[model samples]
Target chain A: MEQTLRRRQPGETVFGYALLLLGLFVMAEGYRIDGLYSPSSAGVFPALAGLVMTVSALAIIRRIHRMRPAHIPEGSGTAREFVRRTTPADVAVMAALMLAYMLALEPVGFLGASFAFLFLSIFYLHRGGLLTALLVSTGSLAAIWVVFRVLFTVVLPSGWLFR
Target chain B: MSDSLSYFLMAWTDPQLLLLTAAGTFAGIYIGAIPGLSVTMAASILISFTFSWDVNPALALIAGVFMGGVYGGSRSAILLNIPGAPAAIATALDGFPLAKRGEAGVAIGLTTVCSFLGGFVGIAALAIAAPAISEFALLFAPRDYLLLAVMGLLLVGSLSGESLAKGLYAGALGVALGMVGMDPMTAEGRFTFGTVQLLGGIPYVAAMIGFFGVSEALAQLHNLKAPRIKQDVSRILPSWSLLRRYLPLSLRSSAIGVVIGALPGTGGDIAALMAYDQAKRTVKNPSRPFGEGAYEGVVAPESANNAAVGGAYIPMLTLGIPGDAVTAVIIGALFIHGLKPGPMLMIETPHLFWFTVGNLTLANIFMLVFGLSGIRFFAKVVETPPGILIPLILILSVVGTYAIQNSVVDVYWMLGFGLFGYFLRIYGFQVGPVVLGMILGPLMDTSYRRAMISAGDDPVAFAQEFVTSPLSLVLALAVALLVISQTPLWRGIRARLAGG
Candidate 1:
């Protein structure tokens, strides 16, 4: 069936190899636990799952290899390029900002850190100017604070700075 | 019959209790609509406040929220393509397409009525056949449950889109990921890497938000400047004719929902997915193809999830076992209120059962009212520029992740999964199976091991037991059929047989 189909895409092969690596890692790690030698052992399931993954991924690689073109197309880096192109700069920035917010959450406090992050993120995404971002951020954070703290009784991070 | 009718009206009799149910249902709709804010999170939080309250009112509020939450999930799924809850994952498959085609209003309207009808069927099943269903549910052995989970994984065959191999790989990866936390049976960590935070396991909700919400948000960035589709909110409620047309399908899906939901360790998510698959195969003339904005797709999951609510209550109320995550939390509330949740509690406190049924029924009614009326506003949500909405969604995802256990670790996990999911989506790997693996992974693992242990760790004995027990044999056959039916060989043979 695979032979009849077109060759796997550039990214597809990379993903297969990545899965192969992950399966190997999982299998290696499964043995670290005690009592995995037996079928009922703690490590058996993970190891078995890992083995299945390893085999499946190997199948993918073999299929890709068999289906590879004779010329062996020069620049096999298109997959990397696709990944790079797909995650545009704005998304990369937004993702980075989110990571920053999470890191700052406990230290800067929920309200303060959230307000700053929300304002910056909104402004960055909208590019609709900083003023609109400020109002929206403040209002949205206040609503969140009220909903979690007042309505649901979930305590937002108070922050070491606040305390 | 007279006694049952009176029990049904119990919640309506008391103004305070009725108000609580109504308010909880009203609040649940909005909470469930938010992409990252899950109903389980909301219900669990509600318990902190409701623990001290009387049992009657507390259960009433929770019941209302549970029913409303299930229906509310589809709201965001249809409008935004990001399912608010796991149960709505299948809903988004067809629903978002409908929204793109400017039928968001009709989609929401049709689903709301279907969900209400599904809720009714579930409640009716609960009311009329509680004991029998609960007993039947108890017949499931660990091996049987494992087969059921396998049956669930078969959904990837339908959900996989164009590549069965990709789906298998993705689903297998999800199962592997689910195995990361501490092994429940042996108290040994599998993939924690000597980290304390990893011991508790990656939070499934965080992964869900990452997979569906953040991934989609990133994908949407590609078309940021595309004109937002205008939703047609002209018809906010289903026409009588439309309802009549879908009534049979809704009822059938609801029955599927109740059975799956009644089983311990399974709930609305599996029920919804299975129902969607069933509709895909059974419905000969869907208004559209199953995945590309089919009304039948929306109807199957929406109805099934709602019906699963009543089904979930069956095990929790009758057998003392929580049917799903929300019910499990509600069980904690019941214990906190100094009431036991097992069979003795039911025998001793029968009123509790009837009152919950009443509460759920009322909440279903409120769900229909709020769900239908709120379409115009939710439809408008899609009209917001992607620039603003995407950022808002991310922020909400952050807050929602953080709210679960108040741990920044979960937020980080959400982000990681979100990035991974984005890559997967671009490469044509559906992210849904991964979440399914995460959700069902632990259950599958524990059941398989327990069944193995029960068989004295002998594979032959385990296989023998499956064949010996009628129930197990039936489920094993279903699993085998599910596996065989997905093969190209099977498809070829089927095609040839039909041709001949």
Candidate 2:
């Protein structure tokens, strides 16, 4: 079934239509703008660009429709495969980790937040391994900190906790 | 020459400068070796830290990162087929193949030497040719610049996968996307959708991070199984015979690197690819076609990309126009330090120029040392499970984005683009053109419009002026040929002509 799609023409057709719609939308926006050569006008380039886009879209549609059929599929199923392969669980975990890091950034400061972020990330990467994650996290943070703050004399963000 | 020698002597004698060079090289290498961490990011991050420091040390640090980072990207390209930066894209073509054949040590060693040689060539070019190049660069009117940009856009045909039409579409789309944000000629927003934050336009760095870094991470997550690479602990030196054989090719590639690097917006990545393509076209009795472990393939790109660093600085120092994004940020750093880069920069700040030249040379030497010593450690990274690496990459992306301006909005933008990039990649859209578009778009737009206005809105007059100017004519022809060659009809005609 996947192989069949690779030989089919639907993908290009879909892409062509998408481009057409986008071009139309841009053209509408371009028309709504003021004069082309005016100092504060926005229409000139957009109108030109929209016309080009629309022509290209029409060309693509014609080209795809006229092409000879091959033995292979038209679509690679790459999009579907990618969506299927990316587990919701993995995304959720990563999102949760990022959220935690953002929340912790100001309160924990650069060092603490970075340290925690590094640890959790490393831990997640290492699959919740405590000792290995701790070692890697501590080493990475210490190195970054010493290099940026001490050697380079960089003023990293310090929170109230550190003060 | 005497003055340059004296400057070199000063650099040699300054232990503090030497230490800074070493540190910068180290940082650049580490940051560059990581898949998502670009040299631009490393340099930008260093800016806030170096904002208060003296100009010389700050320059020394940034130069080290620039040199080291350019060289560092090859590590992953060789070991994992995943280029650490855009500059390393060509390196992966042959570098990974060599690694697969258990010649990783030799490949790395060859690249290291080539990188150093490339750097030396670039610095030499910068030192000798900057004034002359700057004079030439000034001749590039808006029409010429527009043509040059079109030529760059044409490269999408070569870079895009398989389909020429699809590539052009993507390239056009990229250019259209670039037209977003506030128009340069007029203060009105073109595609900002009436947003205040977007009034300043989409940040190129953030877009790059999203397109390359985050999208790559998302892709890597799909393939969690780490391949067991055979570690061949061999002598980490290319044979003298091998070096002699490839010396001419390396020199040619380095020359290409320097020239492309000098061109604004086109940097190490394009140089590397062009060099690789040239080498493949010319080399006889190759071990294999590229992407099959050819040593020359690795050498050409590695040398060229490293050399491009020197090429990029010429315009930056001579005209105050950055050759690439990294240099743009460096220009900001220079301005912050009360140093303006322009025609009289050499006369006003000759010492600073000399110091930079010296620093670049030293950075190349340091790249050789760090590159060889850290291979074992970096190879270990490729061995890590993708599941682990992917999450860590995300964290780095988030932190790096936020750290840029300390703005949450940037992070949100990054994530939005990241998801968009991931989808695009899945649907077979190439990101390189997008990046190229983002970087070159505004320049093309501003320059063309300004040129038009300067030409009194007379299209015929603009054409006449453009054709009459030798430089503009050359660039115009090149752009025309480049665009035409990519069209299917032109390609078919060319093929038919060859057959005839």
Candidate 3:
């Protein structure tokens, strides 16, 4: 079988450049840790690692530059295509829910935050209506609470508001 | 000999130990088969709970989990395209294709048998080769360790993903992430950025859950509407002829698993990947083309990964060096139980060594029984709609992260890494190297520093050591060849050589 080349993703160039910037920033931080006065210094490995990352990012950028431009879907611009491909509605919404759940964990507690996150995500994604989402989320939450809290005895965050 | 024999049979004779082993194996399978749950997470959590227990029972339970978890990864790899663990990444190359072809039953059956045989090979090797290999392992100097870590990163980087460059970047990024804490030797902060939370460094378990678990859940969103594949369950057990046909290959792969697993800073993921690569090269006739539902493809990785469990114990039990992340946790448990685990422990507590060998053997047997019996039920997991499954996976990821330290900060880190990993995946980058790099980075950093210090901080001396020391030279050469093999020049040469 013949090897097939990878098709370019729409925003791959931007992502590659972002990585390059991150690599350079890491190199700067590595240098700031400790100068090259001693080989045994902790900064040396981090610096080396950063250097490798920078070089690899450059190489990747070059490869991405050489690839054929990604094909935009019909009647859509490149930005739209990139958005649709990388972060579609479902992913964006789910990610938002996750962020919200994480933020709410301390204030709302594990039980409240988890229930809301699970119920809302299931309802939106599954589109099976409210009762199905409610039942599934409640059941899963109960199981998780029993296993992790009651059995494992993990000290989950209790809401300050509740207290 | 009789004493050793009786100690070896300890778990088998004790009722509580027997039950624990069986339960641990059963739980390990589900834990490993679940998308967000991992053997490392389970082992670490179990450590916290079981630290107060007697060493024998705790060891038995952990051993069972380790054995079963390694094999369990292949189940998800075959049934769904998502690998349950990094080791199963290679299994999914062909296993998922087989599942798509309605041969999920046959694939699972073949994988189960091969894994059992492989587990036996690893256990037998552990029993026979532990002392000898530990002696060999002791010769690995800091520089040699640095070389081994480099070789591992390079190996994983090249094995997957769209290009070598992307893989290298990911690996380096991981190393950088691992650097985000106080320097071990100097106690000076490296990348703490004046933050108290950053002083402890990023929780790698959180990184692991994010990259492997949350990222996968997000990726599955693309296929939420896609219907699940209908599996044929008529043939759950492989024919005797089929087992006989693959026996030699399974044994060969198991040997590969054992060696890689025995090597410190390496584990089943690398072993399975290498075995898959070896099978791709050696097998003249496969059930089908590799990456297109080949039976040999599934068999090779399944055998190698399970064998790695046994291989992983050798260094942990005999040398005090963990064979893998799970073994590292097991080592901590050993310490908690007031036992040291280095070479002296093998001599001082010979019965412990014997008991472990016996316990691992029992776990292997339990793995096979538990692995095969639950297939019909487990296979149904893949049929679960992505809509519901994705949310549950995310919750598990969050809980797994929180359970590590009860810190909300880790949950945030996990989500951040998950988003970043999702972006990487979309752009055709492999996240495996990143995880491996994170795991190996601190080890590599310390080794590099120690080697440099030993070389008196002279670059020329450090360079010279690579070629002068026999072990260093071999590993250095291996790293050189691996790097060269990934270049375009090497690929061109290979194609020309093949054509000629």
Best by lDDT: 3
**Model 2 residue B451 CA deviation in Å:** 2.2
Model 1 TM-score relative to the real fold: 0.95
TM-score of 3: 0.94
Candidate 1 chain B weakest lDDT stretch, 10 residues: B156-165
Which residue ranges in model 3 land beyond 4 Å of their true spot?
A1-7, A73-75, B80-83, B100-102, B284-289
User: Residue A23, candidate 2: how far off, in angstroms?
Assistant: 4.2
Give the interface RMSD of each candidate: 2.0, 4.9, 1.7
Off by over 4 Å in 1: A1-10, A59-80, A161-163, B1-4
Best by the TM-score measure: 1
Task: Supply every candidate's count of residue pairs whose N, Cα or C atoms clash at under 3 angstroms.
Answer: 0, 11, 0
TM-score of chain A of each: 0.78, 0.54, 0.93
Q: Report clash pairs, candidate 1.
A: none
Task: Name the weakest run of 10 consecutive residues (lDDT summed) in model 3 chain B.
Answer: B378-387
Better of 1 and 3 by TM-score: 1
CAPRI verdict (incorrect, acceptable, medium, high) for model 2: acceptable
Give me the candidate number with maximum DockQ. 3
- Please give the TM-score that candidate 2 achieves against the real structure: 0.83
Order of all candidates by TM-score, from best down to worst?
1, 3, 2
Which 10-residue window in model 1 chain A sums to the lowest lDDT? A67-76
Better of 1 and 2 by DockQ: 1
- Binned by DockQ into CAPRI classes (incorrect, acceptable, medium, high), candidate 3 is medium
Better of 2 and 3 by DockQ: 3
True contacts kept of each: 0.55, 0.19, 0.81
